[model samples]
Target: MVRALLSRARDMLDGIPHRWGSAAIASSSASGHGAEDAVAGYVRMLGAGVRPDAYTFPSLLKAVARGAAAAAEVGGAVHAHVVKFGMESSAHAASSLIVMYAAMGDAAAARALLEACPGATGGAPPPVMWNALISGHNRSGRFDLSCRSFADMVRAGAMATPVTYVSVISACGKGKDLLLGMQVHKRVVGCGMFPDLRVGNALVDMYAECGDMDAALVLFEGMLVRSMASWTSVISGLVRSGQVDRARELFDHMPERDTVAWTVMIDGYVRVGRFREALETFRRMQFCKARADEFTMVSVITACAQLGAQETGEWARIYMGRVGIKMDIFVGNVLIDMYSKCGSIERALDVFGDMHNKDKFTWTAIILGLAVNGRGKEAIDMFYRMLKASLIPDEVTFIGVLTACTHTGLVDKGREFFLCMTEVYNISPTVVHYGCLIDVLGRAGKLKEALHTIDEMPMRPNSTIWGTLLAACRVHGNSVIGELAAERLLELDPDNSTAYILLSNMYAKSNRWKDVQRIRQVIMEKGIKKEPGCSMIEMNGIIHEFLAADRSHPMSKEIYSKLETVLIDLWNAGYVPDVTEVFVEVTEEEKQKVLYWHSEKLAIAFALLTSESNVTIRIVKNLRMCLDCHNAIKLISKLYGRKVIVRDRTRFHHFRHGSCSCKDYW
Candidate 1:
């Protein structure tokens, strides 16, 4: 029906006189129906021998700008018409032409048209023309050109309007040019254009993005009225500045909450590792009846992954389906990561398989997940599959593959991949990759080789590298290399409590009581307190946390009683406390008591008391599991005939039938 109307209009234009023909074309173009139809109507008018006037070209150019497919061709024809009529000198026609070219991502053509303007003189072009150029450059992501144009506009004595300031400020923000942004703010104030809401909001956003939170806050508080975007900018900026508490305070004070505002707050909590708070905020958002979009859901999924809240993450996935939100590649990638992190590798694989498209991140997440779960061979197989599918392996992907080799004690495979990463892939090994290699060698009892690798690294070894070596040395009882690693680690990170603790543990194992005491004294003198070990478990949609020897939960009595029973079973299974694992100079019984109160054991005890028999017990801990805890958990798994999954800071341990998925290598 629209096509019929266009045809009839064209026929009417053919019969109309020249003077009315141009008006007819202008009216048709102004209808804003469709760019193609509008251009067709103009062609009909031109065929009828009508000449385009100054006013006629602008509307035609606007119509051409609206159509992206045939825009260049139609726009060029319109340009020819402007030149033929000698109306290219008209400011209205020239500005429209410039904007049209810019809309098509042709900044070069836009500049050419601007220079061809009859009014182009020694001075700066008109502010409107300059704004069009700046807007075009800014739209095309040529931010530097946009800024330079703004400067030239100023030098030509052309006063900038609110529109001009908006584009320039946006360019400044995108370029991270705080100085230019501040100057733009000053110009806005001097012109009294700060009263403009758009100008005000842009200034605030610019300041915030440029890391000038103080300036951003000042402008934000001074605004007469605030939009959702205005509040979100400040809140997100505060979050980026690591002021999460301040961001939350502002979030609470918001008069109204939009999805973006809610997303910002939830994501802010996630950024600070406050997964519980992030989940709580997400729940509150749902209760408030605000619908979550893909961005919000992704953040919520990440929070769930961090907390191992598989139930919540599953619900979020269902919610997305219920709301008819299509899972794009980005959402799919995050889902893979979320499921993998939540200790459900099968579900993660399902998500990966279901994805219609997979990027490097998707592949990396799955491989890393499998590696951390101690499915090292599967991870390496996936890497080969990724290559077969023609996906380029990035630095992160190699890390996963190398980590797999480390977990599985495939030292030769680890070395092969390490060399391949640098030679075949031309990807330089980062400290993390080097650390993984060292871990592989060190865990295999190749202390000398590991030390040599560190010494041969292209970059200086970081604390993580030294820390990995020290951990391996402690595990294998290599006191000589362990001491050297400890010294180097301390020099790099003077207050690293983990290094001190590991070194002290190694000393204690070798009966170096005096050295252990001296290290303890240093720790005390430096006020370097160790992070208290804590473990978390999720049940019935609630997270329960337990610290060492904690008795805070209402069911603490039952948990401890269950722990006693598990300890008896462990003893029957040939379990004995490795007192040497304890770093302190204490009696053997004291060390045994200390091992009995580990946070992970307490968490498992609570799980055994509360969880159903057939279900897996999943626990997340903040620190590495001690050898005693590792041995006990393995025995508990066998005695109870239940599977237990424990994720420490470094890797996951799956215990079943008196064996670990890591094969006692980790």
Candidate 2:
């Protein structure tokens, strides 16, 4: 089969233009024919009494060099033929042979050919031949040899070409030898060969790889012409260097944007936690009608996950299908996560069910998703399903299992799983596992047991552990344990504003208004500011955000009016304001008003005004949804007959017919 293919390729090469012959050779050799078989076929051709010249050997060796390691070894057998044909002194043949050795990672053999070439008169190889050896060493990743070879060429009074500089500069990117790279740049300019587009690209890539974005940007600006490769290198380097702002700036200034550029910009924003900007960039990408690759959609969907933009994620899913981009395991997993985080567990389930390829990660993502969405039993069921699929559960899977028990207040089940993780699975518990167990005990009102578990921990407790205890303190109104938790938080992390905020929330829950005031004063004195509570809702492809008492939306009037009417109806339905959590130093009436204008309420009101009946209104909150907002949304869902899904900081609260999926346990 190899001989037949090679014979056909040789016959076709004889018929095509010489300029196209190398491409044909490459096309034929890529099929992975054995190196020994290729030589056997060639020898058969020669044995048939065909007279081959010096030029004939270059193309044949070119064919061998294009192949994999097995094919590259045939260079030796082909070299014997070249010697037989008395073409061993041919520079072209020698160059091709050098390339073949380098392709097989035989850098020393390639250099030996250069030194032994009869054409290297006066012990100085010409620039063309030197370039072959230099570039071949580079391809072999013997970059130091490439640089040394370039120096030898110059020292031997041989002129250097732009190709020489290009190859050497490329090696510096991997070697991280920025000084040698800059010296090459100086040499290139001195030779009046600077700014060759290929050399310039290599230089920019080198500097970027070496962590010198400033030099890269400076060189890029001075270039007479720039390609997308140039733009992408600098932008990518900037993103990795944590200067995504500069990357975005360069992205906006790009003369023409390609799919990679757009994707890079969106992902750069996502990496910097500027999720809104990423989504906005995706919007712009859609507006331009530029095509999106799988990578582009991955970044875009991740931004959706971060922002809880379900509608946008669904649109992306539809877009991918319309574009004939099939759902692979990776994309399937991302979609499941996006839906899960957006409080759309049913959609996540749909993605999980439709996926044909299920990796361990796929099962794990769905399990965690179910746990966070208040489907604890379902999550455990999925865990068993994963085990039945012959996939062993890892530590992450156990985290999901424990979290399932945590969200549903299954204290006994949580402890059992913790033990199972250590004994049955032989998975040593990390702090996270212990923290989950501690949270289980804490949530069950076993405050003393929770502390004892912390004391028994092999590792010192982290902020997350104390924070869990503090949160449980707030839940059960245990001022004594809450104080202990707060002191631990201060000792563990003096500057964390979360300790103060959680403390204040606990006091407010108990109607200790003066204590709340004191906590607020301390937070202000320490300049510790917790992020203000904010909620976001997506409707009609637009994401609307609101902060507490926010009136900044374009539909603020309608939202406020709708909220007022809804609250009035709720009050008629026997919904009294849960004023225990109202923290401001205000009168009773003012507190109720403030509660009415909470961020989630505004977002819900906006949805209530615009959405059709029966459409699920999804809201994402930056902080834990407040008590008043949760109770009011439950009533609003009942009063308006809408399914309301709100994903707060920790888990999903799905309100339907005046009940949350969490069953008041969260």
Best by TM-score: 1
Predicted candidate 2 versus true structure: per-residue lDDT over 1-666, tens digit per residue? 323423433444432233333443354453344333454455556657677787787777766765555444245556655665677678788788787777567776777777665544556667877888877777667788888888888887787778877788888876789999999888888888865898999999899989999999898888899999899889988997899988988888989999989988899999988888998998899899888888888898888998898888999999999997756566888999999998888989999998865778899999999999988889999998999988788999999999998887889999999999889999999999998898889988999999889889999999999999999988899988999999998999998777887788888878898988898677667777557889989898888889989978988898899888998898899999987555555689998998988899999888988989978999999888778888888888888889998888887899999989877756
All-Cα superposition RMSD per candidate = 8.9, 9.0
Model 1 spans with C-alpha error above 4 angstroms: 1-142, 149-161, 384-393, 419-427, 493-495, 504-529, 584-587
- Candidate 2 regions exceeding 4 Å error are 1-203, 206-211, 222-224, 387-398, 410-434, 456-460, 492-498, 504-530
Per-candidate TM vs. native?
A: 0.79, 0.71
**How does each model score on lDDT?**
0.83, 0.82
- Clash number for every model? 0, 0
User: In model 1, where is the ten-residue run with the lowest total lDDT?
Assistant: 1-10
Error of 1 at 364 (Å): 2.3
- For model 1, residues 464-582, the per-residue Cα lDDT tens digits are 99999999998888999999999999999888888988998888878888888888777767778667899999887788999988999999999999999989888877898875455
- Whole-model lDDT for model 2 versus the true structure? 0.82
